[model samples]
Target: MTTPATIPTAGDEKLPQAAKQSGQALQTAGRHTTQEILTFTIGKEAYGLDLLTVREIRAWTDVTPLPNTPPFVRGVINLRGAVVPIFDLRVRLGADATEPTNANVVIVVEIGDQLCGLLVDTVSDILALSDDAMQPVPATAADADHNFLSALATHEDRMVALIDVARLFNRGVPQVSEAA
Candidate 1:
């Protein structure tokens, strides 16, 4: 049996004092709800995704470019005999295309029945954040780009924008990949 003290977490040390106290109380009873997020950086911004959606993280490798594909679709790579399309997240998020390098990585994630890779500058850290730390996306930004993000979480005095992969890539979309 795992005791509260035995359970490890990164957010426990960075939570607000009061929230930390409350978290400890909940932890003691083994009832704490910690949201695990996979954080990564694109250019200068921090972004996060639900850890549950992530399948695996792979080092950047050359992909076979697909003709007629959108700019964001950098092409696909064969993962264990399965062809997975790689999307340049920086470009998809309205930034310039990322110049692939050794520092870059592909975050393989499953959305619905589709498995795809998100090309990011670097894989930051997997953080366990409390629900209270997550705030709704700004009203103006949400209204303008409703599907782009789910929420904004504050950790270590930094804001990590939570990417809503499902909404961002809309189900059964040709722009993301071919029907599979």
Candidate 2:
């Protein structure tokens, strides 16, 4: 394997004497030694998300369906007086609409500036993984659903697809236009 190029840092001798000592030139170099993930199930598949992004996990609640939105958009719920859109994780991941039951749950997460809830079959467990345990999604996975998976991690004989919440919301899709 080829050695990666070394980025110049504030401590590098090549920098001007005064510039080398400036803290602005310090290279931001730190790896997450350990990360916590919130694991959930949709269908038979298990998935995970950065625990830091998850605000709360609530039992499944009936939502007020909105007209003219995508099928995957399950509609909004009253979250402490704030209307938060709830996305069906199954449908968003290209599966059929989930038939929510008492066991189902809604994972409230803050994606960007918006707070939305993801409907999942069940909240499984909290997983703690080291940085090295995360593997990049294969380049061959070019499907819409797979694109939302940022990484894969194995937990006790099962592989969990690590969902990228940001990408999950930002995927490019054809826009619906109103016709006169």
Candidate 3:
């Protein structure tokens, strides 16, 4: 909500180099280890996640509704034979529901032993950010949105909020039981 993420234009040679380098806070020689972040948008605002957690990125598709769940729970989609639940990132951030369209995308991510997809407006840049580049979320941001953001960092004059995967589902994904 602070600022919309700045996306790199095509033909920018720097992007490839940034994308190639990434990690999950790992240590490295000389400089701090880089964390590769996958950036995406929800409306105009941009958000990012540690690339190590991402499973894949797929086009938006209709999902089968579940009986009882939160409004943010868009429903479940079939990924191969596996049923993956999709969450509306907008709603999760306490914003309006996203009107699904062909342009939308599902970012499949794995947290611990669980797997799920995050529905967003579109996918953008993969940034290679060093540890020192990241700053803790400001204490002034005491709102519904603050709980979800782990840190904030700038990439090309744009601010990208690093989402904490552990807090996305409060550390536990819904348990889907088998139907006899």
Candidate 2, which ten residues in sequence have the lowest lDDT sum? 22-31
The TM-scores, one per candidate, come to: 0.77, 0.75, 0.80
- Where does candidate 3 stray beyond 4 Å? 1-23, 26-28, 140-145, 171-173, 177-180
Alpha-carbon shift of residue 33 in model 3 (angstroms): 1.7
- Superior candidate under TM-score, 1 versus 3: 3
Q: What's the CA error at residue 130 for candidate 1, in Å? A: 0.8
Deviation of model 1 at 29, angstroms: 4.7
lDDT of 2 by residue, 39-144 (tens): 9989899999988788899998999887778788887888877678889989887879998889999999977766788999989998887656778887775564
Position 122, candidate 1: lDDT = 94
Ranking by lDDT: 1, 3, 2
Q: What is the TM-score of candidate 1? A: 0.77
lDDT of model 3 at position 116: 86
lDDT, candidate 3, 95-167, per-residue tens: 9998999999999998667678899999998999887778888777564545768889888788999998768
Give the alpha carbon lDDT tens digit for every residue of 1-180 in model 1. 875666567464454453465332223233445667899999889999988789999999999888877788888888877789999988887889999999999999987787889999999999988767888886784466456798899998899999878876673245434432
